[model samples]
Target: MNEPFAGAAEKPIPEIWYGIPHGYVQVDLDPPVEQIEELVQQVLALPDGLRAQAEPVVQFYAGFVTALNKQNARACLLGMHLDEYDEPATSVITFSTVPAHGTSAKAIIAGTAADTVDGSAHPLELPAGLAYFSEEERRTPAPGRPAEGSDGPLMGDIWQGTVAVTGSGGSEIVVIQLVTSAVEMAEDFRNILLGVAHTLSFSDPSLSGDEAGTGAREPEPDSVVAAVRSVFG
Candidate 1:
């Protein structure tokens, strides 16, 4: 249970967090937790020019954490940028969980797949009774002021997955998200996302003490490169 994120607990703020039931899972990304917090603090301390660009992302992280807390996620891995920025940026892998009251894994898969004509959904073949995958493109026009690079709209891709596992005396849906800025990088991002999700293992910490289980974990050397390449490449 706590063994997985033990390093997080060692930090002053702790990068890894476990939920009350400890039914969900977590995977460490680059920069960890303390670095992300420190990055945020540095951005906040900046004067006006660069701070304006980074503020939205800082706010977004705050709001996202709030949302996950409200959803009663038992454990999660926080991912974010460690460097300064002038505009809003997205996290690489955001994990969270919510109660699925009788929601069939098939229903979740179908609904997620139906969101895009080009996207496909398939079973994860893991311990979890149900798992789903979906990939899609997103577009955002320049609002008021354009983002750093382009003169027009911005395009990005999102890879999402869900695993339904019952443990900790209840059932929960594990949500995985990989967001990047392009269509060409979809496949790469999807592979990395699946790697993380495939490693997910659920257990009832209340019943099993400190030992939680694991799934078919994939060894990804340089996860940071995988994440960045998915967007920049």
Candidate 2:
């Protein structure tokens, strides 16, 4: 049987479009074993001694996709960023839609913000219609300076940014979620997300790939994916 998000078929109707910068790569839950091997060895640049660890890593992301798909996700992308020291190398962004049916975009946005605990949403100025940005933190680590008790927490913190907007046709609500464990770099993540959010547009659902001169800046570039493609192929 085909696994969840394993090369999901393209939807034929008009869909939402946005920018993905150079550091991100789209995820595919299922791909050939050979490609997976190449992903560990090449894209990730993992050493041969750690070769056996790739399977578990793949399985973790498969579960991640499965969770999103269960909630009506439309697309998933993984970001592997490396600084001068390659710190905080992973982040994830997911695009999903909630059936608006007949609900007003204001109600949807307000209700979402209200439901969140300690949720704060602010007006987002964008080309897209009626958008709000909300941030939520789950299982935050112990409150203290980073250098002290850094390893005390059994689990790392989870940070997420939810960007909700009215669908192009008012029939659905587009939700773009950005998540990462690097809570310390929240400001950087927020800036990156805004760059992407500004580019949002509703377009053909079956829009195969990034088209030239469409004013759609790719969030992830083709060259960035050549290696990432193997990881999530």
Candidate 3:
């Protein structure tokens, strides 16, 4: 038996992708699977009329997984779509795992419409839960404010950043801290940071230039850093 089994074990799947560690969470949306299941169950429980209306919405959510797989194997998201009118539409959100290397995980979000009316394509808003940091947290630490020593501010621990991009337009905000200890935390942070960066680069009105093409502006690094720190503080 030992002879028969020797050197015959199945090789473990290597967790490497695009040169990044294979163990990190890699998706646009990172909602708890249980929460998603619960939401599905609730939708299933609705009456036919409600279910009929909700079917397309649910399909859109499910399609996110497919979209991620199709666009970026390592990207994913927790997103939803609402029909402002009774027309069919499809939206795509892209997530990219970032920070290049060293297990400091992150990702970004960008949205595009397959077919729709004007203004249909826009970056989706970050959910409240993800934006845990208050505006106060984003404020620069005052001269006398308690400095983060070895053990940083309690709020800083849950920091996150966000960038929403819609058809070359969007906004970004940073969350200071969130209390998640999974190995994937870094990846999550990266996603939010990239999302914010992409949105700012593509959308912020300050960066827009007139037909003369003379007034292109760049986002302030301090603002970007503050946004990231606010969430990860």
Candidate 4:
């Protein structure tokens, strides 16, 4: 006998992050947008009362990463709502794969360390088990910028960590960042994020129906300045 709704079922996957234990809140690195969209449409087709139940689903889709520099490159984003997350730092991490041109991970790491050292940056190493490069710097906000009704500028810290990994036929650079006005919390935030990065992993190259690889088509670049203005203006 043929099962009618078998195709619409969702499979459950274990929620383990390397060796770190995650409870209740499950994180999905990159979710299948197509299936989410299909479910959204199905919910929309439902009559009134039942539609409200789909609101959370709609919100979840809103947080989906619609595009990035690499069309098929994998990205991990942690969406924090200002009202709910209440953290002083705004962090962003991006991973992109491109032609290696015979570049080795060791060379990339060395180059990163040298470049930062020239810029007066304090070099930092990846955790005991991870292999990546990182650096930190203090950033003082413009003196005239309005902040907390204060006449003086606000000081903060900015950290960036980068690592290169070999992929199918190219190399991938994983960049982790942390920007915060919370000077007292800066170091803690950096360590926390770096710890999360230590567990980073990737999947094997995959081919779609017509595409050669996942993220094969690049997305149009979006300007951060323009995006901020569009949202706040």
Candidate 5:
């Protein structure tokens, strides 16, 4: 199958600089407003106990939406865009809540971009996995080969990095896999991804508190296979 993103490739290493593969998950508040409002009204009309569980959900949703909007704008400024294949720009603010329950909700966004000697590539592969990671993990680095262009250790394989967020009522994560014709460029990409995560944490208010420290755990290989089957079945 094609890689999660469209422009991914496994080309040979470059002579100039290496590319960095980085990913992260960020936690931001997202709630289905209309649905929550409607639910709130219904709960208020009901007995007190029924409304209690629903109240946290409403609060969580409100916080989520506020965070999502702010983060979306921030991503755009950082050269990231919402995954149009899955969600429209307008609908980004709508109430398409997932079928799960809790005082929390989530919104995932991710993509890959390349920086060449010439120009940068568009972001790709904003998968649900990346989204979930943004909410849970802080910064998780997996073992992978280094890219080409390095003068010391690690000279011809890709390096992977990830960051995530969780807590309150929701979570978000982003992962990046950096590789390039030039090992230098790859290393640069890794640093850039790290900087981006830090910047996101600083700018986005919802990523505050213990939630921002949450790290995403990798799913088991078997579970991954099952998920893929469910999606493509």
Candidate 6:
């Protein structure tokens, strides 16, 4: 379930924009140390059961966000859905851009889906404007081999859904990637992710940002929220 995006501080016009559900919180990529420590303190104050569940989710994203920061990710969101999921599952959503080279959008989508080695990808039932949609589930070993005495999965399976759309006059592709470890919820997440992707659009400077301008395509906050929930709820 989701609510109208209450609103966030004004920022530069984004190349791509999409909506996520209520269970998710956007990770402030450039927050002061105090903000992060405050979050940690809140988690610590939770009851043992809730704290135990939240701690790992926080840590997992801490590491993941660190990696994304180094890659200069555009945006990041974290989802913790203990009630809706079988376990205390976590989801990481990120936005990033990649060069389109000279490839056509359709070809990019097909190639991306075809490259799903461990899982599968395809076009959405409702197309999201020459978008690339994909789902993958795979296990990648941790950076280093496990100790000799170690057992079980050294790393773990990774499940993710991605949506990519061309922007900046086709010079680049903006990607929306959502990753979670709850493999069992893959289908549900795929549905929810598609719902979000369906609402995505690239900001067009040429279009009217003014109320009097014709062909103004700015999204209404409420409509985006409604679209994302149409599939999941």
By lDDT, the candidates rank as 6, 2, 1, 4, 3, 5
Listed in order, each prediction's TM-score against the native is 0.48, 0.64, 0.28, 0.43, 0.24, 0.66
Sorted by TM-score, highest first, which candidate order results? 6, 2, 1, 4, 3, 5
| Global local distance difference test of model 2 | 0.64
Give lDDT tens digits, candidate 3, residues 137-212: 1322222335557354333222233332221111222211112222224454445443333222212233223422
Q: What digit string (tens of lDDT, one per residue) describes model 2 on residues 1-233?
A: 01111222355233765555667777764456787676655635666566556656666666776787688777777887765476756788887777776878667776765676664787565666777898877886543346665656555687798888877776677788898877777777777676566556664222325654475433343232222232234
- Higher lDDT: candidate 4 or 5? 4
Candidate 6, which ten residues in sequence have the lowest lDDT sum?
4-13
Q: List, residue by residue over 6-63, the lDDT tens digit for candidate 6.
A: 2222333345556657688777766778988998999999999999999987887688
Candidate of highest TM-score: 6
Write down the lDDT that model 1 would get. 0.46
Judge candidate 5 against the unseen true structure and give its global Cα lDDT, from 0 to 1: 0.31
Summarize candidate 1's per-residue lDDT along 68-129 as a digit string, tens digits.
55754334453332223344333345555555577754565546655645655555554434
Candidate 6 regions off by >4 Å? 1-14, 32-63, 83-86, 102-107, 110-119, 124-128, 141-148, 151-153, 204-226, 229-233
lDDT of 3: 0.33
lDDT of 4 by residue, 81-125 (tens): 232357534444444444445786446655665676456333344
Error of 6 at 17 (Å): 2.1
Separate clash counts for every candidate = 3, 6, 33, 3, 61, 0
Q: 1-233, model 5: which lDDT tens digit per residue?
A: 11111111121111011111122222233335676677778878877887887777667656655764554322211112223264311111111122223422233322222322232333322222223211111233223445676554442333333433221134322223222222223344444443333222111222224444664333233333233323323
Cα lDDT, all candidates: 0.46, 0.64, 0.33, 0.41, 0.31, 0.66
Cα TM-score of candidate 5: 0.24
Instruction: In angstroms, give how far residue 118 of model 6 lies from its true place.
Output: 8.9
